[model samples]
Target: MNLEDLRAVRSRERSSDSLQDLRASFYEEVADYIQERKDARERAAAEADDPFSSEEVQTLTDEIETAEQVAEAIYERRMGKLVKQASLAAAGMTGDTDGLTNEERRLYEDLVARIEENKSHVLDVLAGEVEPGAEATGDDDAEPDPIDAAHANPEPGELSEPADDAVAPPDSARDESSAAAAMGGGLDGAEEPAAVDDAAVSTSRASDEEGDEAGAERTTVRITRDVGDVLGVDERQYSLEAEDVVVLPEENAKPLVEKDAAEEL
Candidate 1:
């Protein structure tokens, strides 16, 4: 990769780093909470003759008070959230029945699956267990991964910062220009161009013109497989892991068939 490529990669890595950093804070809080919960459970088990307390009793209440104080001292701004998270974990582990609605349960399950997939991907990346990209094959119809769509084809100005010297003109100047332009007046008394010269600039654009990358464009060949091809099941029963798939976009491609009924209307 050249300098531009390197810069692009660094930008991606920096974005990835920021995401990881945000998660790291939560991980730290989780770790500390888990440790404190374990220590309290251990201490409690050793203390009372009847270690199993009543259903009304709160486990590790004393330890939590101390943990809250310590957490506040360490992370003053985040103490509330951290303490609440730790409390929830402790409560969940101790069989304290916190209610989860049906929707919440479904969402939680989805989050768990994503977490698992991310874990596997991270390990695979670290261990060099997978190909850098997908393995090339003669087979057509292999769709690109949806997860890469956001990061794959970055647009111009997607990550650019404005120049330091940029400034806005006064509102009064902006209003005056707007008012003058609306009152059948031209800026700086500009005149209409001569008729002969105007014809040169009035060119018609072809309806089917290709975008900027006409010659060097990547082809996104559609991949179609019978249900039995990969799944070994009927086409109707072919459950898919959409997350594992890579999908490349077809340039200048329009959908042939409308998937949504509303679109037909």
Candidate 2:
């Protein structure tokens, strides 16, 4: 393409949200145009009586620089749009793909595959259908608990009887138990306080569990733009990008939602 055509392509790309149509040989044409200009510039310089003041050579050099810059801008803008399109397709909402070059189409397909695969694995982990890091090792076998194994398969000659020392209480222990029962008015009186203590402990445990659940509060969101790295309220770092679906602590997610950077999912 010519310098004017490159500028026009860059203008269209900047002005439009969607990708503009381009020929299959667009990149090859640009390369050819730049090479032709370079050759012309060299010939002009060589033929000029005063090479330092060659107007044709200077004009060709400027055109080459501008064309390169415009082409790069057009490519970058199109690439960003393609990435977003691929993300949408991965989420099952296919969008327009009317003007993609063969190379771009391949890139789009690869992006979709990678995004879909990663999303599926994350969802599987959240759904409890897969364990984190389980895929890496391909090992699902769990080690047997030593206590459970011993109980499930005891040795044939293992003794089931109690030792001689466990047969009866010593006289001093019996006397102390009898004294405590008498002082408490009965065994029931002494055991009532222990029963209340057990109930108090149970109640405390329940309260602690409730507090833990509250502390772990999270919000699910869909990112609309690249947020890079964010330090979460849970003291962990999160790397977020456009079209990413993730769960963040409610406090950390609040700012992004309010800023319209992410929407609650």
Candidate whose TM-score is highest: 2
Output the TM-score of candidate 1: 0.18
Candidate 2 per-residue lDDT, tens place, 1-265, comes to: 6877887886687568898998867887888999998998899999999878888888888888767756655676687788889999999997667888777888988988888888877888889888877552223487677876775677898744444546678875665454323222100100011112444445545644564687776666666544545456555656554455666666666766765666775
After superposition on all CA atoms, how large is the RMSD of candidate 2? Answer: 26.7
Using all chains and alpha carbons, the TM-scores for the candidates as numbered come to 0.18, 0.49
Badly placed stretches (over 4 Å) of model 2 are 133-265
Looking at model 2, report the run of 10 residues with the lowest lDDT sum: 185-194
What value does the lDDT take at residue 247 in candidate 2? 68
**Candidate 1 residue-wise lDDT at 52:** 71
Local distance difference test, each candidate: 0.33, 0.67
Error (Å) of candidate 2 at residue 224 is 27
Q: After TM-score superposition, what is the CA distance of residue 54 in candidate 2 from its true location, in Å? A: 1.6
